[model samples]
Target: MLAIETKQLSKSFWKNNVVKQIDLQVEKGEILGFLGRNGAGKSTFINMLTGILPPSSGSYALLGVQGPNNAVKKEIGVMPDYSSLYGSMTALKHLRYLSEVSGKKVSQSRAMDVLQLVGLEAHANKKAGKFSFGMKKKLAIAQAIVHDPQLIFLDEPTSGLDAESVIQIHRLIQRLHQQGKTIFMTSHNLDEVEKICSRIAIMKDGKIRRVGTMDELRAYYQSTITVTMKHAPIAATDLATLEPWLKQVGAQLEMEASHFTIQVESEQKIAEIIRALGSYKIDIYRVDVDEPSLEEIFLEE
Candidate 1:
C-alpha cells in the first residue's frame, strides 16, 4: 500500500484557496521532499494530513487507512514546533508525556534512547525553557519518533541549526529512512532535498506545479547537457581534427588552456564526443557531466 495518497485534496481559508487540488502519492519506504516558497500552503497541507485542520474538500489516505483518523494518527508521527514544548518539563519528561499522550507510552529506557538518537542524552534532565533553539529542534524530533511510527512528517528538520547540528540531523534522517520509515518532509533547502530525498514535489500558490525525481524534473525542463573534460592541452593542429567532429554532432565546445567544455542537446552525444577525443589523441584526465540544479529548476517561472 502507498504510504500516502491524496486525490484532489484542497483547503480554503475564507475566500482564499490555500491548498489546491493536489494529487500526490508517496510510496512506502520513500523519502519524499515537499518544496515551496513562503506562504505556499505547505504547512496547511501538512496540518490537514496530521489532523490539525480539516480539508475544505477532497480526500487523503495514510498507509491504507482513510484518515486523519485516530488509527492513522497512531501510525504516523508529526514533528511539532519548538514553541509547543512545555517550558517546565525536562527533555525526558517531555518525551514520556508525549508518548503517553499519543497512547503509545514508552519506557524510560526507550525515552533515553530516543534522546540519544537526537544527541540530547546529555541534556535529558534539562528543562525545555533552558534548551537552546537547536536543542529544542532535537527534542521535537525525539518526540516525533519515540513511539516508532511507520511514517513521519518533518518540516524543515534542519532549519536554524549549526553546521554540525545540521549534519547530525541529516544523518539521523538517513538512518530513519534506512530503518524503512516513510518520510514526508518539507524544506526550503533545495540542496538538502536534492541530496536526501528520493522524489520531490514543488508547490506554488496552493497548487502542485511539479513532482518527480531529479532526473525526471530535469527532463521536464529539457535541460541542456554540459560536458566538461579536463585533458592535456590539444595542439592547434589537433583542433582541426576535433572542431569539425563537434560541429558534425551539433555540439558547441569552449576551449581553455587545459580543459574544455561542450554543450550538447542530449547525453547520447557524450560517448561519441569522448571517442572522437580519444581518436584525436587528446589525453583526457577527467570528465564531468552537468545538469540543472534543483535551485535552478525551482526558480524557473
Candidate 2:
C-alpha cells in the first residue's frame, strides 16, 4: 500500500475553501516534493493529513489507516515549520520525551545519537529556548525522527537556516532515504527540491495543478529545449546559409558573438541541428541544453 493516499480531500475555514479536492499518492521510499504559493493551501492540506485538523470533505489514508488513527500516527514523523520547543528542557530531554510519547522509548545514549545526527550534539545539554532559530529547527527535526518512524513530513525544513545547517539537513535527509523512509516535503527552495525530490506535485489556488518528475513536468507544459552552443563567431551570411537546415529541424535561433541559443521544438528535434552543424565543421566546443528552471516553471504554474 502507498504511504499516503487521498481521494478528493478538502479543507475549508468557514466560507473560504483553502484546500480543494486533492487526490495524491506517495509511494513507499519515495521523496515527494510538494509546492505552492503562500495561500495555496499547502499547509492546510498537510495539517489535515497529519491529523491536526479534520478535512471539510472527502477522505485520506496514511499507511492504510483511514482518517485519524493513533496507531499509524506513531509511525509517522512531522517537522512542521512552526513548532514550539520547551524553554526549560534540554535538547536531549526533548528527544527523550518524544521518544516516550511515541511509545518507542530508547536509552539516553540513543537520544544523544539522534542529537548528533541532527548536528546538535554540542547543544544536547542546552535549553531549547536558548538555541538559535536554526538550532531550534534542528532540535525539532531530532524530535521528529527520535522514534525511527517509517514516514516523515518536513515542511520548510531549511527555511531560516545557514548554508552549513542547510547542507547538514540535506545530508540527514539522504540518510533517512537510505534507510528506506518515505519523505513528503514542502519547501520554497526550488533548487534543493529539484536536487533531492524524486517526483513533484504543484498546488495552485487550493488544488493540485500538476504532478510529475522534472522531465515529465517539462514536457507537461510544452516547454522546448534550449541548446546553447559555444563555437567560432558566425557571420549573418553563415546564419542565412544555415537557415534551410534550421528550418528542417524547426528551431528558432538567436545569435550573439560566438554563442548560439537554439530553441528547438523539443529535445528530440535538437539532434538534427547539431548533426548539420558538425557536418559544416563548426567546431563546437561546448553544448548546454536546458529546460526551464524550477523557479521559472513555478512562476508559470
Candidate 3:
C-alpha cells in the first residue's frame, strides 16, 4: 500500500496556481527527499496534504484513507518549516499538550523520552522563550514524533543545527526507518539528502520535474561516462595504434604518461575498453569510473 498518494493534486489563489497538477506517490518505508527552490509551492503542496488548506482541485490519500479526517490525522505527524511554539510553556509540557490534542496523549515519562531523542531532555523544564534557536527546532521535532505516528513529514529538519545535532537527527531518522515508518522530508541540504534518502523528488514551477533513486537521476542527466585508468607507461607510437579500437567502441582517449582517461558513451563500452587494454599487455594498476553526483543531476534543466 502507498504511504501517500495524489492524483493531479493542485492548489491556486484566483489566477495563480501555487501547486499545479502534481501526481505523486510515496511507498511505505521510504525516506523521500523533496527539493525545489524558494516559492516553488512545496509548502503549499505539503499544507494541502496535511489538511491545513483545502485543495482547489484533485485528490489525495494518506495511509490509504481518502480525505482528511481524525483517523488519518492520528496516523501522520508533521513538523512544518516554521512551527509556533508556546513560549511560556516548558518543552515537556509542549509535547504533552500537542500529543493530547492530537488524540494520543503521551505520559510524562514518554514525553521525556521524546525530548531525549532530540537531545533536549536536560532542558525539559526550560521554557521555550529562553531556549536557543537550535533548541526550539529540536522541540518542534520532538513534538512531531511524540505520538509515534506511522508517517512523518519533516520540513528542513536540520536547517539550523550544529554538526553534532545534525548527526543526532540523522541517527534518529535511521532508527525510525528501521521500524518501517515512512518519512517524506524537504531540505535544501542536498548533501544530507544524498546521503540518507532512498529516493529524491525535484519540484519546480509548482510541478514535479524529476523523481527517482540517485543512480537513476544521474543516468538521466549524464551524457557520457568517464573512466580513468592507471597502467604501465606505453610509447606514443603504441598508443596511437589503438585509435581504431577506440573509435570502434565510441571512446576518446587522453593519456598522461602512465595515467589514461577515456570518455565513453556507455558503461558497456567501458568493459570493452578494459578487455581490449588487457589484450595489449598493459598492466592496469587501477580503474575508476566516475558517476555524476546528485548535485550535478539536480542542477540540470
Cα misplacement distance, residue 97 of candidate 1 (Å): 1.0
What is each predicted model's overall lDDT from 0 to 1?
Answer: 0.89, 0.87, 0.90
Give the Å shift of residue 26 in candidate 1.
0.5
Descending-lDDT candidate ranking? 3, 1, 2
Model 2: per-residue Cα lDDT over 69-107, one tens digit each: 898988999987689899999998999888898899978
Pick by TM-score: 1 or 3, better one: 3
lDDT of 3 by residue, 1-301 (tens): 8999999999999999999999999999999999998989888888999988899999999999997666889889999888868999999999999999999999999999999999999999999999998999999999989999999999899999999999999999999999899999999899999999999999999999999999889888888998898888776666888766676666667768878788888888878877878888878899999988877776774
What's the lDDT of the predicted structure labeled candidate 1?
0.89
- After TM-score superposition, the amount by which residue 110's alpha carbon in candidate 2 deviates from its true location, in angstroms, is 1.2
Best by lDDT: 3
Could you tell me the TM-score of candidate 2? 0.94
TM-score of model number 3: 0.96
Q: Report the number of backbone clashes for model 2.
A: 0
- Give stretches of model 2 more than 4 Å off: 233-240
Per-residue lDDT, model 2, residue 118, is 84
